[model samples]
Target: MKKRLKLNLQSRLQIKTVPSIRLANFIELPEKEFSRFIEAVENNPLFLKLANPLTPEERVIIPQKFPGTRFSPHCFLSLDEARLADASPINLSPVLERHHKAIKLIRKLGLDKFQKYFIERTSAVLPEDIARILRLKKSQVEAINELMNEVSIHSEFYARSSLGTGHKISYIKVAKIEFDKDKNPGITFFSPRHFIGRYKIDYEKVEQLKKRDFFLSEDIGKLNALFGKLELINRRKNILYQTILGIIEKQKIFFVSGNKDDMVCCLQKEIAHKLSVHPSLVCRAIYGKSLELPRGEEKPIKDFFLPKKEYIKRVILTLFKEHKKVLSDNQTAVELKKTFGISASRRAVSNYRRELNFPSSRKK
Candidate 1:
């Protein structure tokens, strides 16, 4: 007969928002052994074959199932997000509303031209590339000397984002738990759990990080290349302002002429789904953020889209963009429905103005 010794103990080790053993992406370090890192990430069964792998699939997420209960306590999070989410919660209605309005204003202002101009500063486009893309005069392209002083694109404002909805992630995490070994050989485990982090990230720096490279990356070139792809992150706090304003600008079509019924239904979830991101991402992007409009008005970005229609948006922006001193939504809606086939009602229009998040509107 064979006897076994058993030690039953439950010890909980809490990891805060960070501790990434994962290798850096763009900027490489002398201390970090790249070959070993590749081997670990590639999971080459032979270990030495990381240098020469037969399969194209290098980093694979293997899924597993634990049929039952979890034993240990783990507060796992995407370290970066937790840091951002820690420093800023998306729940700040005031900030979100303001951001929404400011972005709306900025879009009305056409900041993309600014972004485009900024990029034109860093990278040059041969006449061939521009000919394939846009139709313009040779002198006009040459005049872009004003646009591209550096003879290249600077990548200051292209960012990837969509509206988002909150949801749970589906990655497998195993936490072995107490089980009866007399009947079962393998211990029970827990996975896919969500927990809050102990520390917070600096959004101020995260914002600063837009123009700058992340502190830890495998290749600076790759990081810079990633920067060129992502214009959202910028060197200034104002860029966050610009981004929200940009989101507002992009969604201007739905806001101005469309109502709750004809409205494009810009649900955060729908936008998130379109962009293939988690809702918390949308939440984070929109949180603790506000804007100062021209009228000395301040509000959160969330207030802009939570309502059903964009009719008020069209009226207000048209008035401001086209430079009309005062135009009523009733008048605007009538013109839109009659001329452009836009759907809006007068009462609904007033409600829309009220939704613009103007504090004085509360008096109405």
Candidate 2:
């Protein structure tokens, strides 16, 4: 009878679990409010910070504090207690430490001026030369340059907050370019947890709360809410990444046809349909995000999702350049189908050509 009661309680708790708030709404929040929200989440009592440093792969664990049957109201373990409980403390990555130091040095030396100097220079500038100009040590310059190169390739997302007259910027690694064994480029995404670390659940404390008849349901519901948001964000990001990869693979011919103007058409609705998600979710995932290409160009995530008509126009222009001679609408339409496997009516081709302001066959 006791075991049956316990099972019934567990089922009730599972059934009463509340859903998490929408990640889209959280992302679409204003900058100041968003920062505050992040601060609140990070400062929650359930999340205990680690005094000891953490390795890249290590996560902090919330230790059990009260061992006896009697449970204190303050059941959660303190930071000191957690540290003491941990037998093996992991050290932070040296590379990550150096990167942080470099960012600080750059901020102190004036980021605006440094960027201006680089932009004004016509030729490639060396780190030593930059250091000489900025009155910084060669090593410092080299470290700063290394961090800058990483940002240019991996693209860190910076959140800014007002600090008196000046502003303070904190960076988080969002996405990075990864290569396969074949040397083909792909994308790897990192969640906020990757940069800010997370605390493991204290199951002992949870069990105690339940035994004490404390309102564990409310706390569980809150946690479930957070989990829901994180899960949704991760799912949407994965779908978006896979959709982009699929587009690149299917449109290889468009990419390699020596047409610099031609770009992959990745509409949000189309991607959502292919991935079985809402278009609004895709928009939220892409909002305020930038991706860095292998060639060091940083473009907004939305730029990848060009309108279908724009892509078609670029292809038509490419076709015109390839032919090297004036072609009538009928001829252009035929060539598009034969060469690029794109079928368009002659009348539609004529409309697109006029829209591009290209001269007619007679005018040429």
Candidate 3:
């Protein structure tokens, strides 16, 4: 017989919300369960290679089958059952009772569904209609309508967010240069130097725990201490912020308007010095992160720190003009290597020629 062992968690279990193909796209699964599944998948290399990987949603959700059933013990619902449980009719009145209860309801419905429910239900009922239906005073109905409007706005905001709704950004756009006495400092341009946002912390719930009878004074003290520690962890900014800011500050002219001519050679040590940080720290900060640009394009942050490769394409174009005819890929590669000491393969030369809209040498 196989032994079934249940792992007891002493600390809080972090839940994962992943995107799904199902109608309920925001699938919340236990961290342990998801980790175990991932491990199982990793064991089968062939299956992993063939399988379509799961993508994570921008929003995080705590899904439950019904109200007051959070950490919902078990989830064994059929697809048909899930499709049938419409969120529009679930008792949303409980949500208005308390802030935490509202959060719970939002979690239960998932952000997408809850927003849909709110929009559909509220749009169908005016304040007067709600007063008549729910037998509430006009003032109460007005309040409810106000809250629903806020919910709708937040929903639309999250839906349109780029770089995931999880990442909140505060940016500072400053002029690239100050006017010099002799130099032609005529044009003023703006560029984003720093990006930041406050960490989300649920302090209201911590304060609410005082009302529970089971929570003794000592427990409250311990909880406060735990919150303090948690706050410290959450409050610390991402180390990469300073590095990115340094890069932007140093390479302001190039980044400000995406003009390649304005670009100057920049090194990681230069950025580190600008930010008063170590060179390794600068490297680590920009390793995997991408910077969102003003033109709705995103480029790897590290790309900006490296030497620009556009010059190679320019040189190839110049060579073609001088030759007064398209050059063969091999011919171009040999010329680049021999004349400029540039190591370019025939394939790379071919690609550059194609990018420049020149016919292949054979076609010419």
Candidate 4:
């Protein structure tokens, strides 16, 4: 018989394990590298050629099993049980149908344009007249008008409650600072409160309808799906706020110096740690996302997380521009250590200088 190595349960339990190769690679990639990977996967001809075709039925997968159970469907009845009990499938609620129709109309009109038209009309204007003006059916217009009325009420309430605070009160429009051609710019902070208000409105509507015996079982499922969307939006909004805060906290000197060329660096790992999530999840959450800054400039979210090497290069460039006397690699490295708390070898500084196309001190 061949000799076999044996381990005690406690020894086996204490053995170290590593994450999967794919997850480890994802977590290790720098912001630029990860962005390039995403771009290649999305747009590269070779990857596109390798993509598998999807079937019509496989286009969307619907979950049939009930939550926390393995076998029971959401209907809670097997086909045999339903047949024995002579139970019928639940019908959609009329209220939910009307809500869907209004959503369809809103999509066609565009949310911003719809809101503009709605606000432009005076209080005296009737729903019927508004329907005629927009070339929409009267019922659809009524439904949308009702939803907007609730939104306006909620907006007013939040404005009053959140006054003098940093909290945002609206989410429908992208908040951006508008600058005059020759004047100071005004800032409008982004807020996601409208998502909560809309969710509350739907919840109240569903409750009222259920109390009146108007909602079918299927309507609850539909409403739950809608609520899930609102929750997702709220989660993304929080992640974005957290990422920005992390950047600001990590680059205090950059913001305080007020110099555009002042280099700032924020790593995804730091943000992931702050948010108590895996770095790969943070990367996935922000990939391909862009936001409008306070100064009216739009930038990719990943641009905020700079690699250590690139950030050091920018710092060296800024140092060169600030000082009139040309400094040798050793001197630059010393300045980096003294000013930015960064310790770089003279050789490394020389390499960075070369990469930045800056002349050496002797050449200068």
lDDT of each: 0.31, 0.47, 0.40, 0.46
Over 28-98, each residue of candidate 3 has an lDDT whose tens digit, in order, gives 22212322333343234322211211211111111111111111111101112232234322333333343
The lDDT of model 4 is: 0.46
Question: After TM-score superposition, what is the CA distance of residue 173 in candidate 1 from its true location, in Å?
Answer: 30
Tens digits of per-residue lDDT, candidate 4, 75-139, equal: 11111222322212222233334455554666677644564444333121445666777787777
Residue pair clashes in candidate 2: none
User: Where is model 2 poorest over a 10-residue stretch in terms of lDDT?
Assistant: 67-76
The candidate maximizing TM-score is 2
CA displacement after TM-score superposition, residue 245 of candidate 1 (Å) = 17
Provide the global lDDT of candidate 1 against the true structure: 0.31
- Stretches of candidate 2 off by over 4 Å are 1-23, 30-39, 47-181, 188-223, 229-259
The sequence of per-residue lDDT tens digits that candidate 2 reaches over residues 1-364 is 0111111232223222323235456545543344345445434543322111122122223222111111111111111223223331232233345577675665565534544333222122445656777888888877765654333322222211112133132223244444445545444433222222223344465455556554345565665555453333334334445444544444444334424365666587876555555677667656655444444444455666777678777888888878886689989889888987888898889989999998789888
Off by over 4 Å in 1: 1-51, 54-267, 275-278, 281-311, 320-325, 338-342, 354-364
RMSD of 1: 25.4
Residue-level error in angstroms, candidate 3, position 183: 20
Ranking of predictions according to lDDT: 2, 4, 3, 1
lDDT winner between candidates 1 and 3: 3
Candidate 1: residue 243 Cα off by (Å) = 13
